[model samples]
Target: MQIPEVGEPAPGFTLPGTTVRDGARTDGEYALAAEIGRTVVLAFYPGDATPVCTAQLCSYQEELDDFGDLGAVVWGISPQALDSHAAFAHGSSLTFPLLSDPAGDVVRAYGLVAPGIGLRRSVFVIGPDGVVRWRHVGLVGLRFPKAATIRAQVEQLVA
Candidate 1:
């Protein structure tokens, strides 16, 4: 399946999952439809506890405030189980939500799932109106975008 493109409506999803560090089941269903009125940053990492994954997650944590100030909600999705996600988030002190997509249902919908591996490193920025505004698939040595890059894109949507 082709990845959703910019200006395309993000595929709606209500995935069952647990929180990053809290180990608590989030009450409300997580759906792109519900996030329509706000900017949503959906990031998919490989697995939990790996070196690259660790740095990627921690970077998102460190930039939480900046993302919040831009009025964007950030989320990380992986194929790990709830317990593992919880441990990783707790150890990293990540502020955003980390959800489990063990079945790869959500990941597949976003076209982030690799044939053999779980999820490809990718990030999609959804506009307030629910259209995908930006996306980046796997890079050899993927690095999270700098704060300025994030701010610029978000400002365009929020403006």
Candidate 2:
């Protein structure tokens, strides 16, 4: 299936995740409607502990403040379980929420599933009104944006 086009409402998700900072397993229901008043960044990756994914996630973690300042909530999603997510969170010192979509529900909803792999590297920028404002599907052989580029996008969206 083709990727969800821009301007579409981001598919909502509610999945169980373990709180890394507190060591508590909890359900995180991330609905587009719930974030209607604030921008939401759903960064999907293939897996945790991998090099490319690590770099991508770390970049997101490093820019948490900028995103927050723009009134945006960022969530990292992968097929990994809560425990793996917890480890990835702790290992990378991630400050945002890392959601576990073990059953690929969210992935399929967003049409981000790679044919032979898992989740593809994609970023969905859901505007404050719950409409998708921007999306980038993988670096795809180009030197995709670093933290600065993403921050710029957030600033532009909130501006």
- Can you tell me which runs of candidate 1 are displaced by over 4 Å? 20-28, 139-144
Model 1 lDDT per residue over 37-134, tens place:
89998888888888988988787778788888889998888888777877777777775777778888888898876766667888889999888899
- What TM-score goes with each of the models? 0.87, 0.87
- Evaluated with lDDT, which candidate comes out highest? 1
The stretch of ten residues in a row with the least summed lDDT in candidate 2 is 138-147
Q: Which residue runs does candidate 2 get wrong by more than 4 Å?
A: 22-27, 139-144
- Give the per-residue lDDT of model 2 (tens digit) for 38-71: 9888888888888888888888788888888888
Candidate 2 C-alpha error for residue 25, in Å: 7.3
